[model samples]
Target: MTATVGALAPISRAACVGGGVIGGGWIARFLLAGIDVKVFDPHPAAQRIVAEVLANAERAYGMLTGAPLPKRGRLTFCASVAEAVADAQWVQESVPERLDLKRRVLAEIDAGAPAEALIGSSTSGLKPSDLQAGLAHPGRLFVAHPYNPVYLLPLVEIVGGAATTPETIARAKAVLDAIGMKGVVIAREIEAFVGDRLLEALWREALWLIKDDICDVETLDDVIRYSFGLRWAQMGLFQTYRIAGGEAGMRHFLAQFGPCLQWPWTRLTDVVDLDDALVEKIGGQSDAQAAGLSIRELERIRDENLVGIVQALKAGQGGEGWGAGRLLKEFEQRLWAQAGGGAPAPDPTAPLELLEIRVSPAWIDYNGHMTEHRYLQVFGDTSDALLRLIGVDFAYVEAGHSYYTVETHLRHLGEARLGEALTCTTQVLAVDDKRLHLFHRLFAGPERREIATAEYMMLHVDSRAGRSAPAPEHVLAKLRAIADAHAKLETPAAVGRAIGQKTRLAAPV
Candidate 1:
């Protein structure tokens, strides 16, 4: 039952054999991608826990991207493994890590699922070969390891066993890609794969730090989070080190730091004993660090923080070498294209509906409303949309002629809270060869109550010359057309208002 890439259809329905943390996360990821999920977990609390995970996933997804997503798929709790995998196009086995238990579950799923369906094991460290041993259609079985909070993180490690075929790996990659996951295929089955091995190494060192009483759990976390963790978020270790070479590059860096590797700085070669006393000490410290927050609360904090960091990266705030942010931006563009499709037809009779956005948790201030800065961002996005509508795209900008905002006046009429939907409508007030004036209004909810308004004056620039220039003829024609259509509507009163009110009385002493 080896399945080729061409044979694999977009997975409309998926099955999960276990509904623990990892399994439930898988269900959330699938459901968020609009794939119906059938889940089987023997524990009575499975349904409740999975539902909680799904809720968290929904929040994370809402904050991750502004691109429109498909409607959420259905979820069903099945009575048994056979029932769960019966009609699934993809079967994900996330049972316990024990080899025997996983093997039994894999066999059950293999027998029940269609032969053409791809079967993936969510084993963290167990070899896929052992899980697929003695199973029918073993070629379809492979490992699809994912990070925690699966719906938010995009990386998924795809590993195949001895009996697994290249076709199976290809099919798995295709499915993962469709769901907005980056599938890094392992050339050979290895213990813990790449990410876990790196994580395990760090975990071992962190444990030794605690065991040796060198630092508490909180201090260790701060050390990483406030320093190297930030560095790793964009450029990883190698690139960071290369930059540290101070004009000499990697060769110089290695020469200077190579000898320090022999120093007793790390305990990677030795194992730390996790005695009862040590475990209690570590657990107590962790609990105290969290204060009184529940697991769900901690997860929300984590997801929100992750979204903020990724968003920063996407904005290029982490600097030029931020590879992760660059990748994220590229991925979001793809999602936008998939959702928005081809260029929209110009409509002259009305204000152009340019941008639709969901207020991410990161955009909210301490007052629990969208912060003032985000209004500017929304208006900027709307302006960019208008540019695109009039034939100014990446190529136009690259050609050295594009619009640059010279001035903006924003009026905040109301408040927008987190997760609230926002839309921006743009009207081309006036346009000439060198300058364009736009008035944009922000509305909230389906009824479209006004939330804010922005008036922008932009000048066309020949970027190479660093001076004003007439826009290309095609772009000017489009803008003129939109302006002509908008002329039928009454001018907004706020369009020309100054920041201060008119003085009704003479200056008072």
Candidate 2:
């Protein structure tokens, strides 16, 4: 069966024609999205290079989110482009940036790949029209330029050639969306596309500054990273500048800074010469900036930082997420929704196993065990799982009625170390029209033993009204079914016990 997240149907098979840096990244992203990939690259070290890239992608994905990723797709290294693209549903070409080379390779792919297969080129600056010139099925090809570390970055410029049909562009975009990527179709193809154009402008200015000894590479990087770069990550260029307009808005802001556009300070129109002396100065400063870290080490550090930033964004805007983080939130919602709908029936006599989690490295403390607040987080998530099980979902909450946890009692029984698998079982203690009583046990580590327990008192409320209220009968009925079934089990010893109550496992570890 094809593995799918959310309700999006993923492309079943993909052919990646080049396995260099960008190629490998494309391959990893597709495979992680549960699409089998066939790869063809003639470079002797291509396999090893792709393997390393895949390892990093996996580590990054593990830290990125706790949502259940679909099962990984099978990877096969093929000898020829024909073998790889013979029957693939999608084809990606990541060959080096030479128009002639790309056309030659795409010709073979065009002949061997299924006529209807979606094909994309990873050319940073080349136009899709130039690359499509020699293909028999030119309408199937487009430029899908992505940034470095394609797996983590969400943006992919989808620029169609003159010969490319609208249907092909739409299909390409659909596949990108299904794989949790953002594909912005450029209205018209240009030499360097949108992102690279902006980047090249900045690079030109930076080069001129270095050539004139205005600032070292390190200093230039620090200035950008410490200020506007942060804003750019969450909000793009125009949006950031719009805020600069202040209360007056973009028109006023543009009028304020518009005069600066003609200033002589910028050398954007002039190209900086990369003479030997200038190259040496820039290269030496870059070496010092690296501070002795290897390329792979720097990549890992960058990946970790990107993961944290995106995760924080996902928790931003009051948990509604912002920008790309919002997309992640929506994607995770779909994953959870699909999983919930397809889950098997729970054993009525036992506590409902509502959630399972992997302890991410980000959650570890100096003690190297799961940290203090994460316990509360786990139990809170467990409660959320129960709430979702009983119909307090996004729509229910959106309607302005929800079960609010009024009280929580947590008993941390033992340590939960890093990378451990954990699960939570919740037993409903009592249910009423306006209140809910629940007991939750958390199992940690490979053994999945009981490591913690939480008891909660939730009050149903009309959030818009700011008062307690009865939940709809539909919700109450499901609650009644579970609470009645749980009534058969003996009450937990800690059910009503306050903090500091004596028990065999109560003493501090």
Candidate 3:
């Protein structure tokens, strides 16, 4: 579990301390987002914790991918915190929320981690100032608080203390961004931070309501579940209230609430802490209401609800923290210095297209098997080899001419799995001035048994013309040789697709 920096850096490995809910949550989020994770938790249930967290993460990622996740980033469970932190660029500590425990972990992390690495404590209430008191490099330590189910939630509040540096914050932000997270930086570090402070204020008011017999816990939840809570899902307080005032907006709402600020209303302070008895009562009531639903079920409901709300906001076609519909325009142009996006596939008959390809771990799909699309891609590779030999260069196409696949017939004969070596061979079946017929066969590399076969009809095209055209002289000559050689043998039925309208038409029919 004590992996070297070299091993994790290639894939951007992160370290998580404590395999409890929060630690496990961090591991799941990072790993599922294609970041390798090294975990250290003394609890015997660490592996199970990781497995369950992975399962949850996988489910969440599945929603995004619309299929099983691609080969996920690797996961490593460490024997100790030092081993986990040894080479990690980002170390997230989720030990018990006790100040001494955090102080000890941060101190140990500072000793083991690289001087430039960021060490974040996932404490909901403890201030970064208190946590950094015992650290050797206090600047590297900060609060990286995440809401529950970090895998699904995109928001992370980054609170840095007096000793924390701007560079450290930027480094942490870069890592989060790479993992598809949106981070908001707290201007200044404070106890309970922003999110927790807001939640605590609500909790304090809710407690007062329950204690004074104003409303039951479920009823208070209903008020939130139905009214402002619904609006808050997409927009926060000020924005929601601004909309409530119509044309008057924020200035109007502020002017209205400004007068009520001094009036005695609900308490937002923590003077009435919920002691153990109250905590137990609330826990019992929650269990009574939700005992029928499993934790996994609850997570599903939560994620689905979030996705619906966020997607709705996104549909509104506005900017963040406002209407959902934001117009996103994407522009991309590839400089065609050469003709193609990739090197031509190795030829099977000639030295050019023939290649000994080793199957990588990424080739497998959600079924824990090689996917059909990859086989097609490999065949496409073979076609590229055939075209390159005949002078169908990428530059030629960019200049206005290209080859288009009119038809392809493919068959999977045997299963190909990960770590398998495979061989692909492409042979020309027929050729004319404007079209080339080709077939490709894939075989298991070691045993030399055929695994898949494909036959395709390739049509010469003037991409600039958007129609078929005759091959250039040099290109036609290469196609002639391959086609002439294949004509000696019996061609497969799939390779005999009918030729379309050729390039020499004087006028439209």
The sequence of per-residue lDDT tens digits that candidate 2 reaches over residues 1-509 is: 11334334358899999999899999999988878899999999999999999988887876676665666888999999999999899999999999889999999999999978999999999999999897899999999999989998988999999999999989988888877889999999998999999999999999999999899999999999999999999998899999999999999999999999888888999999899999999989999999999988898888877876887788899999998888888877766566566545567689987777766666778998888888888888888777877789877899999989999999888988755678888899999999999999999866778889989999999999999999999999999999999999989998987877663455497
Best by TM-score: 2
Per-residue lDDT of 36-132 in model 1, one digit per residue for the tens?
Answer: 8999999999999999999888777667776545667789999999999999989999888899998888899999999898999988998888888
- What's the best-to-worst order under TM-score? 2, 1, 3
The C-alpha lDDT values of all candidates are 0.84, 0.87, 0.69
Model 3 CA lDDT for position 210: 75
Ten-residue stretch with the least lDDT total in model 3: 327-336
Clashing pairs in 2: none
Candidate with more favorable, higher TM-score: 2 or 3:
2
**What lDDT does candidate 3 reach at residue 200?**
81
- Mark the regions of model 3 whose C-alpha exceeds 4 Å error after superposition: 1-11, 66-70, 273-277, 318-509
Please name the candidate that would achieve the greatest lDDT relative to the true structure: 2
